[model samples]
Target: MATFAELPDSVLLEVFSYLPVRDRIRISRVCHRWKRLVDDRWLWRHVDLTVYTMRPKVMWHLLRRYMATRLYSLRMGGYLFSGSKAPQLSSALMRALGQKCPNLQRLCLHVADLTTVPIASLPRTLKTLELHSCEISMLWLRKEQDCSVLPLLECIVLDRVPAFQDEHLQGLTRFRALRSLVLGGTYRVTETGLDAGLQELSYLQRLEVLGCTLSADSTLLAVSRHLRDVRKLRLTVRGLSAPGLAVLEGMPALESLCLLGPLVTPEMPSPEEILASCLAMPKLRVLELQGLGWEGQEPEKLLSRGLPHCMVIVRACPKESMDWWM
Candidate 1:
């Protein structure tokens, strides 16, 4: 009879990947053959270290040990409080990541301190990057390189990164190949910077703009002027909205539009009006209205008698019927 260790390397590697990282490490001590099988590159393709808080030193140690060239996605950081307020991703670990993870495409850091991590040390193969509630030094965000840092980058999500300002957005314009961009909870970004940054992304397809002071008309105009190819959009509005909105008229490729609102002001365009414009689009399929409570009953009534072509989605952001804005 064959034992567990007698299983082929292919099957063992696939099955062992289902175990937790710590459990794999524990099982590695069972025998040298099992250790060799557990250390396969396929088992380390996607690694998430955010299930619980870890010390900065320990995190780096693990990364240095298992940083595989076949890695595809890496997500690190949760909360800090394990004898340290800020969990650090060291420059050495970053160097190792660049050297080891040549195939890595996604890197997500949440609530981590990136003061020492070098932007140049990032892997060139990265296509998706997400930084949530991260802390970075001024010099880091302000640093400008002569050449493209992540030339192949395609998607970037910056959430609650306070230091990300117009300069960063302007810097982003250099990465013209990006297909998706999300900028949320960024207070320093303005309409000028947003327009300047967006002017070059002719290939951008998906966008989400939240936590900014941009006007709806100006933003729509900018999108029409430059990012006309965008198929899906989410723009959070603030202040007064006028009776007229700059809907994507010529954009036949657009499929979804989620307009998060500025309440129902007297001068504002009605939700029904926006829906009417959306319904006229050539290929638009989804129109989602968020945050704005129903200021009138006609829009709801119009929604009930919806047409066959497009979908009118009315969903609340903060639970149901409760006023909560992103």
Candidate 2:
């Protein structure tokens, strides 16, 4: 067997690829050639620092040493930061990401304070962005003058952001290339802003809006008018009426739809109307109803009878709590 020193550069780099960023950084100190080989661009293509909450200083050290232009995907759990210091660290990190990792495509951040993070520092090539339980100060998202930042982004997931509102949704309209968007815990967005914002995203193919108070008819009308190509849709509706269910006929391309709310009662839309709407959808194959307790007879059986081509599922929510945390 060959010794560590006798191993070829390709063999050494391949071994380092499987190691965590911390371990790779540690092993890079073993020898002069190992230190040089560890900096190879291919070795840093995909970096996930989410396993542990990273320290700011250590994150800075790694950014300076290992993050490179070849890095494609990065997921960093939020740093435990507070007050004035947090913005400085975020700005510095974003600047390094902009300056070094020009090819970064997907970025995920959890529990981050996004008050001072600059949109300009985000790489122009980025295609996907996900922010979970992040603190985004009220209207801070709409304050940016550059509306087209991340213009190429195709997907965005904003979860558990209570401060996100109509103006923030309006700001997102600039991403004309957006194909898929998910919004959870955004309770402040209403029909007016939701309609205006979605009208601009004509390319949207998939959309999910939960914990918002929009009526079902208005939401479906907007989707039918603006997002004609939407193949999948999921939204929590309020005060869904019988005639409102007929709006599904306008969306011929929809393949999957999920309706969610407290419960589907006799007070809500009638089962016959819903069944008729299900049969009208041309390409629909999957229909999911969650947290909706049917009144007399379950809508599932009625829909299955009308739509032999569609799969109908009805589920009671695991818990009554709509808490968006975690």
Model 1 alpha-carbon miss at residue 240, Å? 6.9
lDDT of 1 by residue, 241-289 (tens): 5433545765767888877764545656566666566656677877777
**Residue 150, candidate 2: C-alpha displacement in angstroms:** 1.1
Alpha-carbon lDDT, every model: 0.73, 0.77
List residue ranges in candidate 1 displaced over 4 A: 1-20, 23-43, 64-67, 78-87, 139-144, 240-244, 261-269, 294-307, 318-326
Q: What is the C-alpha lDDT profile of model 2 across 1-326, one tens digit per residue?
A: 99989999999889888888889988888888998988898899889887766667888777777787778899876653544444233766777787788888898887787766766666677899888777775644573556668878899998877678888887776676788999887768888988888877777899987665676778888888888889999877566776777777857689998888673445576657777777788899998877776654457777788888989887775463245322
Candidate 1 overall lDDT versus native? 0.73
User: Over all chains combined, what TM-score does candidate 1 have?
Assistant: 0.78
What clash pairs does model 2 have? none
The 10-residue segment of model 2 with minimum total lDDT is: 80-89
* CA error at residue 24 for candidate 1, angstroms: 4.6
